[model samples]
Target: MSQDRDAGARLGDSSLLRKLNLAAALGAFLKAPSLTLRELRAVIGVSRPTAEDLLAELLTEGRVEETTPPRQPSSGRGAGRPARYFRFRAESGYVSGLDIGAHKTLAVVTDLRGNTLATSRRELDPELDAAGRLSAAVETARACWVEAQLAPSDITGVACGVTGTLRAAEGVHDVGHGPVGSGLAPYSLPGFTEVDVPGALSEGLGRPVAVANDVKLAALAEHWKGAAQNHRDIVYMFAGHRAGAGVLIDGQVHQGRHGAAGEIGALPMLGWEAAVERLHARGAELARSAGTAAGREGEMVITSAARQDPESLAVLIEFAEVLARGAAVLALAVDPEMVVLGGGMSRGGPILAEPFRRELAKFTLVPLEVVTSTMGADSVALGAARLALDTVFAELLAVPGS
Candidate 1:
């Protein structure tokens, strides 16, 4: 018996070692997907027991689950049991997404699976400083937690999408379009200097925070779950609370060399002063015709008029036409598969789609499909949470040999 055991030990074909390596690979597989055991073994290299042990650890921690059990042939001569496959628990933790707009800030709480559990919104005074507005946004997020019956500890991280420009080192700056800046509009709030909105938000929630442009966040959300899903390349154009855009290429956000990939709003649609004047004029016209209440009812009137009134429709078509011109330039540069229209303006789908498509077709020969976002106002918040989840998974996968 001792001789036989010795022979068995000597006959080690390294199958055990392979399995151990596979176990280590399982952790990385969980983070994303579509990894075969063979691929894992090549990368991690371990015995079967070690692999099994790693899988067991993940199972015990509830961090992984069998998404697709291994397939085995019923009549195979050497087959015993099927290999079990596992994946990360995408619903395990929750992340918070905050979208700060010109008039309000919205916060949404979602799990790793992108399921929203609660949401909150607070109207802004426009007169409030950056710190005050951020504080209000934090409070609103806490309220959302309460509404969802969740404690602050339940959150993993917070992601914020803001208007205006941001610098990596100095953080979000009230530059170009703030009260003190020469571009966009005037916003006279103090702390208008480079303020780290994300850092402040991270401190407030006691977790790390991610920051993005509001338009970019909307684009991310749409790319993930709305109109742009399955499109590897998409351009998201937002025409509300000021016009801006976000570009997605190969399923990743493209922020450009200076993190200004989609700063289309600053693309000199007109001279800065002319653009601001046009904005004010447009706002005033809408106010007089729609009672200037700036509520849903007023917006409806503006939309309704834009539809029935040829003159009004022409004006709107012109907006879409210029936007299409912008999109044409984007297509010439990026050549995305789809262009998604979002924000309050997108609520008028057909009102804008046909004209934009027609105009865009005139400029670019690329067969680009244009569509309206169905995620509506929730897109940014949803995208923020998704971004946070992605960040967490990326960190997990970065573990050595994971």
Candidate 2:
């Protein structure tokens, strides 16, 4: 009996090692466009036979495919026959990302490597009930999948980003009582905090869903493919009709204990609410004078400022000063290397960047570079897709029964 138990232990150890080798080979393939047997063995530090075995298994599973290397010109020196190479099958599956905000819901479909394949957007009434909003988000996701010509089974993972703090309990995300003192309540969907966001999205979309704060996802988007990609520690400020922030430390989002790591705008003393209201009031006045709809008043104000409107520029400068105060608080605490300004206000471009940088410099102990988001309104949804891709890779690389 003791001998049998020892043999079982040996089998378990061998299985674990095999799993590790397989994961390493797969990671190498994902990073490089293609790899030969010798190249893969060198990368994973495995024997030639072991690397070949792993590639065979991956090929059988349809996760990898062989391809001929590019032809080389004949020279006096023999470079040897071009070695056959293998590449990861990034088209093996797909994932979906959804951004459900107060005013709009967006869905994006992506391949394994986070390349956008299809996208759909839907406008939502801020007064819509929680159920109505959830239904709209689901519809948008389905529309995106249809546009991509993919079936539900083709989706390997899904993630959703929403406004407000998310509290997870038994896989259900309870969006907490919404943000405070950010002047977004008037524009937020009613009763959004009282629903299970992940559960609703998962059921409606016919798949499991991961949920996160929209601002946090925006920060992740910046880290993944935006201005902060090269920086590890960052402060991502979402300056829209409402104000919020997201923090990244050591290249990972710092969500605090309850996933509220960057709710500094919630503090009434920060004056975030007052500043937003001031912008809104001025925008409304500008819109009325121009005989245009006030739907995008804040943007109008920024546009006017861009055109050298003195009054608009002054309001923008004051808004920047107020924003700098809250940003300084975050910068002082985290000492981030960079701060990325995103959302609608960022579209003001240099007209906004100059004043914001000038004001932020007044409070920070050390100088920090501030850049605008290039992802624009799609940042949250793109971040959601990234999260979904992560889930797919985790599952793909997971070792069974270990």
Candidate 3:
């Protein structure tokens, strides 16, 4: 039995072992920032020779860089040799994230550590065609990088969040294109149905681009840095121009088979479509009552009305209840511990949250800790940045499918 166990241990793949060792060293450097070879050897619990070999490997890949330490003072006997230190090069490359919506496009640039160095938002011309809109998104992305004094060449990867199902060949189109349901606008932008979004963005940005459903990216943002951090399972509901949920299960965003898992609002039977419709209708009413622009009905309008007028408050409550209906169904299916309310409507604060709780309570058997997204309007773009970093780290670390 002892011989057999020894044989099993000896049979371990040497290349895989080295990979694990390098990854461990890289992780340690990221946490420690600056670590000496002796400190890393102790932390990694490896022989000095093995640690030296791992450090060389990382240095070769530029994943880690060595630094000269300040001269050490002489001890009672003699001067101790100053050991060289290494640090994780978190800014070795940059990434960009874009959130493409009907009304506007938002872009963010970040370093490898996910620090938002700059951002830009541009409203779309409703009259523009698909090509024009794509140009606008590229322009905004360029503007963000310019604000950060970076060129597109600095970007290692780019990920985008858009308001519909993404088929690389078919571009982005609302689920309404199929009987998947509606409340979403049709693909009115000429040539949009065949735009090749990722390809277009890649060409415009001079790097490969990945596209994801916007609501799903919102969920990813919440999981990455917002209220859902560390929780494996969460439901991120976006209640702005449209209401939808981004689901995370077992610590990963659940894209499902075709990436349309949390699109319940598409079902008119769910009442989510009417919910948003009524909110806008009430906003127009309140705007007129306040002697404001009748057509100026949006997230702010709902929040203002809910806060200032009794009748508007009632409308907001109903609106929140309608969203709760969809959320209730999602919760029953996913049983997530956290639900993050986000998007433009979430700016309404308690106006949306309070009534959402009241209605969600009726259907849920257990208490769900609901919170608002701190990323605000930047949620989707930031989430896309997270995705871009994953891609960057995967290639940088030489780990496949990161």
Off by over 4 Å in 2: 1-12, 68-80, 170-188
For candidate 3, give the lDDT. Answer: 0.79
Position 168, candidate 3: lDDT = 43
lDDT of each: 0.70, 0.84, 0.79
Give all candidate RMSDs, comma-separated. Answer: 6.4, 4.1, 4.6
lDDT of 3 by residue, 108-209 (tens): 999888888999999875556778888899999999999999977888889998877665445676643342335344333445556688889889988899
TM-score of each prediction: 0.79, 0.90, 0.84
Candidate 1 Cα errors over 4 Å, as ranges = 1-47, 65-87, 174-194, 269-292, 295-301, 400-402
Tell me the spans in candidate 3 whose CA falls farther than 4 Å from its real position: 1-24, 27-34, 42-45, 66-85, 167-173, 176-191, 285-296, 307-310, 399-402
- Give lDDT: candidate 2, residue 328: 92
Ranking by TM-score: 2, 3, 1
lDDT against true structure, model 1: 0.70
Q: Model 2, 1-402: lDDT tens per residue?
A: 332234345676777778877988899999998899999988877777778899999999988999777556875755778578899988899999999887889999999977899999998877778899999999999999999999999999999888777767533233232444544342334676566778888889889999888888999999998989999999998888777889999998898887768888766677787888889899999999999975687789988988889989888888888887889999999999999999888888888888889989999999999999988888999999998998889888888876
Candidate 2 accuracy as lDDT: 0.84
* Candidate 2 residue 139 C-alpha distance from true site, Å: 1.1
